[model samples]
Target: MLFERLRTLPLRLLFSGSVALFPVSTWADTAAKVAPDIDLKEVAPVPRPEAKAPATADQEPSPDADEANPVPGEPEAEPAPEFVKTTRFSLLGSDVLPGTSTRLAWTPGIQIAGLSQPTPVLVVNGLHAGPTLCLTGAVHGDELNGIEIIRRTLYDLDPEKLSGRVVGIPIVNLPGFQEASRYLPDRRDLNRHFPGNPDGSLAERIAYSLFENIIRHCDMLVDIHTGSLKRTNLPQLRADMTNPEVAQFTRGFDRMAVVHSTGSDGMLRVAATRAGITTVTLEAGESHRIQEHQIEAGVNSLTSLMEKQDMISRMFEWGDPEPVYYESSWIRANHGGILFSEVDLGARVNKGEILGYVADPITNAQFPIHASADGRIIGMAVDQVVMAGFAAYHIGTEAEVPGE
Candidate 1:
């Protein structure tokens, strides 16, 4: 039963065991314009340090030091190389420049404004040129896991040793973040407002500004998120494995257990893909709460990614080289009542297993809910009262279909 359950579970891509975000493609294509190449130009490279002269053996041996210290023929310690660093280039029509590992809030150019409020972005620059990695968090606002993860990562990475640039935007939907809600103040899903309109609604303007100023600038991206308030999730990755380049990057996350769907509309990953950007999602913990392990995993995973980018030399030790994959789905409540989940995050469940039970607090009657397919329980609702058609739990397997 356990093995069968594992086979049916949906795969959630865990970013260091953390949760994951965006917009649809058509709109992004129209609104998210990359800064003109004129904004950047080649400059002279910095000179390297001169080599020191070799020491002469006969020059001097102190009678007392000869016995205590090593001979002059012994190799001397090498001098550390002096690295020339470049600053992050300013975005178009704006003079804002991000410091190494610092998060910056932005105000887009008139070309990007549907209205005028600062759009937030985080930037971490590398000492040398390489890929620019942009990570967007909390696009839905309620997905708090990414917000914390991006903040901590930006605060921790040292730019002096970085190989490529890293940009993090912890909360793109400032209004939604402020409300601690999923949708923006406009009551629209910011994720659905992708590649927004500078002349559109409040949400559209914000989305358009981000796409123009931030998303279009990066070569790679990782959007972070979490399960909704009522549910909890196990970590996993979501990527469009159909694209060879994206599949390669997706395989880089040593801990990712699954590769789920990315064909949906108005999703940031889909938009990025259409724009010829490599993007993926990382799912970690529940909404509105901090999970220490999840945070640690996210930071470490990103650092390891930095290492892979040759931005840094340090490596983090995680688990096995490969992870399982699964297709997943949510099980909605058939009846209205309080829920008592029998399975926890990462727990395996079989078809017909009593994964949880719904009870009417007033009537004190219980109704057991079963898994329709074999898989692991990646997410479950914490809220006891569930209305019919309301999602109660999420299940998935790590198995890849023959062609998927």
Candidate 2:
């Protein structure tokens, strides 16, 4: 019975692990935007360092022996290149050298019309040794903002100066992306099949392939996403704040709202966290369209993360920190009709304040939708027709929600 209940839940509800189902609607015309092609221009070839000349044995030794041996007050000699701890990062059977970048592809066993498709991976291995940070986007194919965010972030990075490595998968669902659909050709949601089985369904095999090959190598993870169809979300980070490590990860994204959500089953964040990897999900804008503001914010947040990790030297001033919301609730529409929103995203609201109204077009009657609790609007439905019981406004409240 539990399995049945979970199986019947809508894909949007899967984010919050809510069992209730609502009518799922999307803008069909907005789905055809192609995933942006990676620009090779950003990755320039690194010039080799000049080799130092070795002293000849015939040369006379220095007159001052104290000059050769460092005194107590003198600075110590730097470690030789060979002595430096340099790690050769290997992924998908390819070895990526320090101060360079490479692309790795993963192909599942299943083929569409007998043609196998490969997922593109971008890896930048820095010269200095440090942690491995993984950046993934477009887990749900229709979510395009994350795809752009990953691309922009990767483009701005320089492996020659970076202390750690950054691995990026710009588009995780090629088939769904190609079809402009949220699910695979089999109509299965790929986000719900993490750490998947090799012998299970097609989505499971694909998930297993990703987990074993790519995800397992990460020390830290930031999975980017956007709101579901017909819904728009404010830029925020969702993480399990109870865990010290998770809380630290949340703090890395400067000046961004942090929402505490101990992600649901089969989610990449949850699975990665179980594997002892610090993980967080970045939700911004909405699906099917690329919003420039959201994309820029996502890029800046990632830059902030790298700065926090001491992976790079560039310091970004992110003004004033945002609060971490522990409790949140969705205000459902009480009447079905054409909806108009009075409040904007991220607007503060008090208890019983009117957020929007549902109007009967035929009768010209309007029903005011009031907030159940005092909070800020973290997410809301775009101005459109809505049905009764539809989640219209997602408010981040001051009260802590149970089990969160």
Candidate 3:
């Protein structure tokens, strides 16, 4: 009985530091017998495989899962929205926001004895996006008609309804305007120096400043002027029609005569055109004093041009279209004396027609000045004086005229 009890003991318990003196079947029987009332099934170890915890319904998937498991035929995610940008218009360090107007005084670096002169600038920025038009007057300071024209034009503009911006410089040559002369204090023609050199002469420096700071901002330009040196021009446009853009600009002035001429070197129009800006010159009455009729005509023409460009919503009424003359000549005086003109501007004359005559008060002699071609009188000399070879009349010939 003692040997049977010893053999019935568990071999695992005996091997875990206690010596086993029984077989395997005997050890199983002994373990069953030892734990009979202690429940032997509870003491046995359980076997299981490794697994992850189940996710709750409210939990989100990992980033790797989102990238790996894309929905079928679904587009990629969109980027975040960006901030909106607004348009701002500025000139000569002065900002003119949309639907607003401002005046800027531009002073170039060129000075006389430590004194700088400011050129008057008027800017009107529109509420909508569109082209920029630049209007310049009094390039020759003595040309007062353009100054008045610009003033009247600016006075009538409403920035709130305008489609684009308009920049007006009523007086470009301040020194000449103050002195009532057509040139600067140094006697240089300011209009002749354009796209000027920064390190060049005084006139050139001024031109550079104006061109770089003011004109370079324009997509289109209109340079207003009047006849120079005691001469009067009928309302007309002078432009180089070789450029289609310039030709279109000339057409904007409905009833004004257009004279085709490539402007001289260093001229503002020429320089601006070379830099890809479409430009035209509007010539009106004579210089030194303002002519009411010329000023009125200039104002109307500019208004009509703005209308054509869609800068303004108002529709301007224009008269019958004028002729476009490709060729014109000046009728010069043959005798030196006091002069009188029998014909007025815009008068049509036949070949050899007597438009004016020169009278010599000393010798009581008179000479008739006749038109050499059948054309309209576009420009004439002032009635004050006459000299041999003086340009007395300008005839706008129909020869070589281009089709409208």
TM per model? 0.72, 0.78, 0.77
How do the residues 278-331 of candidate 3 rate in per-residue lDDT, one tens digit apiece? 999999999988799888888888888889988887857789888887889998
Off by more than 4 A, model 2: 1-39, 42-86, 112-114, 398-404
TM-score of 1: 0.72
* TM-score top scorer: 2
lDDT at 379, model 2? 93
lDDT of 2 by residue, 1-404 (tens): 86798578652233221222322223212221111112344452332222223336897523211111111232332221221123556666544555665555555546642354456677887778789999988888899999988888876777778788999999988888898888887889888999899789988988887887789989999999888868999999989988889987787897689888998988989988999989999999999999999998899999999998999988578768787789888899988999999999999999989999999999999999998888899999999989999999999965443344
**Of 1 and 3, the candidate ranking higher by lDDT:** 3
The alpha-carbon RMSD values of the candidates against the true structure, listed in the order shown, are 20.6, 21.4, 33.1
Off by over 4 Å in 1: 1-88, 92-103, 108-117, 321-326, 400-404
Local distance difference test, each candidate: 0.63, 0.76, 0.75
lDDT for 170 (candidate 3): 94
Model 1: per-residue lDDT, tens digit, 46-107?
31222223336866522111011111232432111111112334443222222233323454
